[model samples]
Target: MPIKLADIAIFIITLAIIVFYSVTTLQKDSNSSYAKIEIDGNTFIYPLEKDLIKTFHGPIGDTTIEIKNGKISITESDCKNKICIKMGKIDKLGQAVACLPNKLLITIEGESNDEVDILSY
Candidate 1:
């Protein structure tokens, strides 16, 4: 049996799509592990070294933060506008989670023991 040119083209296109999807999915999964969450003056460190999901609730515009499957994101909120939810997921140290309506800010800080000294003249 002989393969038609159109059939070959279709097969190539399908393979390309599959490869693209697989690469994208893998990238997203790998990136999830580095997720972190910060709220108010306190920062929650999610090792993500193991599979874990954590949920946090605060008075920040009535918002809830959810960290699951190595990804940290805003799960729910009672604010009139869900702007924080649209901020999407954060997976880096020093990243922040904020709810403007409730005046809540969360920032991820590094675990370094270094101290800062200020000298006044």
Candidate 2:
């Protein structure tokens, strides 16, 4: 059996569509990772999409963490420097805010949900 020019063109178009679909699907990343707060070695996890405020007891005193509009930040900190609050808001995965004096570490934690898990340097 012999294939015509039109048939070959159709096959190439179909191949291109499949390749595009696969690449796009594999490249998709779920950016809904939760915000994690650590105080005195204790970890607390909250969804970044949820808006709320939480008070955590740190070394100095209570540290207030607020999540609004998919962003997380320290609104109040009892630590002398208040550096944690100064760190500002973060919603992306792997971002963090820390107050050493208060033993606090706030981070965005979750798998990237991408095509590859391990990257070699």
The best candidate by lDDT is 2
lDDT of 1 at 44: 58
Please state the error at residue 74 of candidate 2 in Å.
0.4
Model 2 — TM-score against the truth? 0.67
Superposition error at 110 for model 1 (Å): 2.9
Pairs in clash, predicted candidate 2: none
lDDT of 1 at 71: 48
Q: What C-alpha lDDT values do all the predictions have?
A: 0.58, 0.80
Per-residue lDDT tens digits of candidate 1, residues 12-47? 999999999999876534222344444555655555
What local lDDT score does residue 56 receive in model 1, on the 0 to 100 scale? 56
